[model samples]
Target: MEVETNNNNSYLSVVRRSSRRTSFPTLQGLYVSLFEGEITSDGLDLSISNKNTGKEFNPKLLKITFFLSIFISTVLCLDHGFVSCNLEYIEKSFGVGYAQSSFIGSMVYMGFLIGCLLTGLFLPVLKSKVLLIGSLIFVVFSGIYSSKSLTLTEIYASRFFSGFFQAFSIVYLPLWVEKFSPQSSTTTWLAYQQLFSMVGVFFGYLLGGILTCFTAEDINIYYMSSSEKLSSLFISWRGPFIIQSALIIPIILILIFIPGEILDVGDQEQLSEIEYSKTTGLLVSGVDLRRSTNNNLLPDENNLNKRNSKLRRSSVLLIPSQSNNPNSSKSLEIREICSNPIFMFSTFAVCGVYCFTTCTLFWLNQYFVEVIKVDRITSVFSVACIYLSGPTLGVYIGGITGDLINDYHPNGFGFILTLCTIFSFIGFITSMVVAQTHPYISFFWGMIIILFFLTSTLPMSLIVIMKSVSSKTRQLASAIAQFSFNFVGFLLSPVIIGIIMDIIEYFPFGALKRRYNPIEVGIKIMLYISLPTFFFYSLATLCSYFNCLISPKITQKKIIIANQIDIPKQLFIK
Candidate 1:
């Protein structure tokens, strides 16, 4: 058996070299990736044998997690609290009104959109570590500079620059994690990566509130009411930005410690060992046939051939060669993405949900203070606590479910996504109503419920996008999809909400100052967008369940290549 195994390896190595002659250039080269086991606690062997039953502390995974945590937290938190918690402070400092502040608020997003698009454009040439470090430096310095801005123009320029650079880190984060993640842990780790950013956003808000509460000075620079002077309400808005910027220095150190280029990530998974037999025909599962190439194995196969033959039975699907086939590179072809129904429908769903989500988050703190009649500090802290708790639970549950679905066809995800969308819509409406009706006492609970239901699906949506495309194009696909959803949906949502609020002002009771009801009405109206979002997701569910996401044949026969080991090329053709 050992002799046969060595023979198989030699034969497969030849096939691999030959295949490379025909592999696509889009992937740059034929890098055969394998999945490796994670390190376990007790300094145990990193193997599949133990199955990690003891819940070992994996040092490698821990290191990766810690690195991502710092990376994401530092990048995301750059502007997290700036627009959300301190817009009023910005307004006061610049002596600007709502319109100017809102435009200022949008500058960061604009920069992010530009950055996301840029990532996809230059992905082929971009080195992950260099790009990330450069972006982090840009954002960190920009953030610190923004803290010292004396005018609205300075703030605008600084925020845009910070957001633009932050985009590189954000765009690259998932791709790198996806690259390094073992198959067993990929889905969950992706969720955790997202979890890190989500946590950072909440922490930014919390940190801002804390700094505000503790750092408010007796000398009031901006005009302040007695309550404002005491409540950390009027001053010290710059403290959070400075602290977050300073904290980023440590993250850069962590980044520097991570070895290798960004794109050089892959996992190694063990397959069932191959053994040759002369009596019985070669057994097949997902094993590569080249592993059974030994001539010395039992003189003849039991059934396959009375006379020994070089070819062995293959089960695992074969990947196309990189340069040999013109169509191989088309696997990541842009036209394929645009023409696919599953991608289009799923993208629509993502855009809708992201729109509503971004809009709601932008206004949540203000809603609590102005409409719910909660104290500003309580509003910030309460929202922070809810975020800290709800998102972690939601994202993990969603991620776990996503991993489990690999057992089913890619279309199987549609059903889960559909259910998630429905739950999100219903939960959002209920939460909105509850917040409006109960205002203070029960609003927190309702929000917690809402976030759990809505956010639980967030990770799945991402998983859906990742699963929809080939591994080679995953980063580009993700960057494009995110850009489309965020740029279109997020950009519109805030503008739409603002318009609704402005129109409400025309009524005898429009502004919050005049009547709190407009804010409530506007929020409720915005929530209605979920209807169409659910509609599209439901359509996606149906499309996927029916196995309907196949792309058009560019006269190129498309076959479903899975994340598996090498197999005979003839066996995989459609």
Candidate 2:
């Protein structure tokens, strides 16, 4: 049971140990496993194909988790879509201005940032399944409360709780989905995760628009006169919140039945049941197969003793490797993630993309109503529907391209992301200029162009970041990235634009005497945010290029731990 290494080679070798050491023993920083790929002495390749695996494992669980992850992700973003879609309605009901309305959207993201940070503290100590369910329950209550809120303050409180719970789901969903997915298709699963999130955005808008139309009819105001004020006293914005709350029911129930922790091959009890032939080899006639094989292989006692002694020295692991301590886990992971320029820059790129996306979704419908002179219902429906097409195609296109490119080159994701950013920037300029055209022309062509480019960044950035780090740090890698995107981009974009719109009005007494059209200048300024995203994404690609340039340095420092091993302090993975 020894790892065979050619002394002539400077790199570490991956070899099979005898049956005695097949199961990895957890020590600290060296037991990273559950990922499907071979780590050659040269490097860790994310593209390694495990063909026999498809034939070996059941397809049913993968399908279940795949759809489940998507559904859950959609549920998480519903609040964003629902609230943003009805921002105009919400403001009318409470008699609030653009800045105050922006706070309505920002509150949810405020919850998101706090929740993400909270996970960084508690995820290591809590069971992810339990945490996910608890978060959903919290979401259910928070949403129902929002539906009943009579004031903006009450709604803000409700939205914060909703975002907080939603963050836990974000933290839990990716890791759980990855754990339950086939090793060969981890990136694909993650891609679909983002795809379904976009689906939530669409549904949020659809449900919000539909509810608005239905409730408007109830109050006998299908389309108010242009001269009349928005009468939210009669119109029901409550329906969308209620509908969003209702959607969580199915996600929670489906997740309840999801299969328990995936049993690994290293686990003795599960391994015995799955590998009948291997167990038979070990227990036949009560004889120890490994011992018998070792006796036959070794010439004498001295040789066996020397081999065992070498393994004992080389494999001994120190407990609670300093890197694995609970108190330091988050700080260490964050530090490691920040230090990697590719991860750091790609994360910023991701944040910029989200900022552009949320601002567009929040403003586009209102923009059409104001600038293009489109009808309220038509504007809402068109904007939401147009927004839907890009993400549906973008996620699939970006994800598939990334997976394919990674097969040939390690930096393919960064390359694809950079391209996406560049294209989206072009789309943004086109959309801004085309606003002078017919509303239908801009809605059908310009909106789709801009959205498709912007939405593609998420799945690509996600896959690239996950691949850049070790498995030990994947959760925090994802969490930190989400934190960045949500905090700076998602949380602030609406408020930033809203504040700009407010500044344009210049109410010395902080009163808004106007409607949506007055903010067209602010909307135009927000369009420029995509420009910075291009710079960040291009820099991410540059970092990735250098990452590949120093491939030998990277590989030489690489260590892939398949099983846990005890060792001295001097024996870190590097």
Candidate 3:
């Protein structure tokens, strides 16, 4: 049996190398390889297996879960995009100015911050599925409430709760991907998750744009009060929320009916030693294949000495080893995560990226309508196209690139991040500086370029942060990341931009204020203020790369732990 196992191992290694070459270069092949996890295009072995049982689990369950995850992400993101694009309508409906209307956006993040706090508190006590179900229920209710909201206060409350519940999906969905996805493909899967999120945003903008086109130019011009606004025959701004509520109902049903035993992200120990099996292709259940490697167990004295030397060098480069015990106190886990330099830097990088995105998406529609002199439909649709062509597609590209680079050399992922951030910074500055004098079409294309680089950093940043922590701390880590990114991006960016605009509008320029359009000048200045964030993003990724130099072991262990694989004692070199 031992001899046969060794032979199978050698055969698998040879297949892995050859499979890369034989793999079809088409997008269809990649898609089939990702979800179906089968031998694709004659050579790529994408199927997952069980090392102990020497069998593959049915792909049906995985397919359902994967698509379902994507569905939930996409649907939730629609609400965000809808609200963002419809901010002008919302402002008129509520009879509020830019500063007040900005709350509609910031309030969601406030709710998100609170949700993250509660999720961190309850995560250990409840199953993730239970939390997810509870969150979805609230999300549905919030959507319904948002559509029916008559008062500015009601809109604020609804959006806040909507944002609050969304935190659960944001934090746990990626964890679900981590649980069921193949280790080798986790980055790609996450990128897909983000890609769909951007897609949902685009569609949300599309929905809002389509609805806005039908709205009367003076739809809410005569309505002064909340009751009067609600009394109108049809309120276009509320359409997306109503539609979102209806869509969520069926999703809730699907989630409820899906077997908990299959979908639940429970304790990792309850799972078998899961890892990427060379023979099985991508994912394998119920086995530790750490010792399957030739480098770990060579009997020859020369090979043994060489392996030991490698281990010694690796040990020096690793930081203080993380506590693997899952039962460790939440406070301790939080402290460790907060103190980790890599996690902190990655969070900063994500913060900068998300902040830029939030500001652009939430405010650009209004900026286009009021400043660029474009009609409402054009502004909304143009923003939609930017989202679709830029971040939506960029995230997918980043994920694929990151995984391929990591496969080539682990250090390569860091370089990818650094280069992406630099491009983003340059693109942002060029776009904002040039938009003043360029044609709107030119400005639109510039935005697409800027967002492409800006959002491509997300998947890579997420990968870095996830790799920086232990399995026991991942949920908490995700919660912190959720809180951090949204707080900076969603909660602060809009409000800051809004406040700055108000300040500029009200500033005692006397005669000069009439000469310049305050809205135009304010937007330009606000965007420039935000430009430094991209520079910081570049700085953080650079710092993360240097941090990785002394901690490559942590990277390897975390990747294994991410797949729910327990390291065997024998696999460790003495």
- Ordered by TM-score, highest first, the candidates read 3, 2, 1
**Candidate 2 lDDT, 252-322, residue by residue in tens:** 78767765453121122223223332211211011112111111232334544454443332222212223
- lDDT by residue (tens digit), candidate 1, 285-395: 111223223433332234223212212211112334323234554453565455545566778877776665565556667778777788878888887877767776888
As a TM-score, model 2 comes out at 0.73
Query: Would you list the rank order by lDDT, best first?
Result: 3, 2, 1
Over 1-574, each residue of candidate 3 has an lDDT whose tens digit, in order, gives 0111232333211122111111111111111111111221122122223221243445797778789889899999887787777776777766777777787868988999999888766755677777888899899899888877767778899999999898888877887776677647878999999999888888887887787677643444444456545533244767788778778888888888777655555554233223322112221110112233443333444543453453343321112223334576566667767766556766776787777677788778777887778987788788888879988767878898778765654422356557567766776776576556547877788778777877777787777677556554676788898899888877887877777666656668655457666556655654564366566666656654554443333323322222313232112212
Candidate 2 lDDT (Cα, 0 to 1): 0.61
Quick one: best lDDT, which candidate? Answer: 3
Better of 2 and 3 by lDDT: 3
| Every model's TM-score | 0.70, 0.73, 0.76
Taking all chains together, the TM-score of candidate 3 against the true structure is 0.76
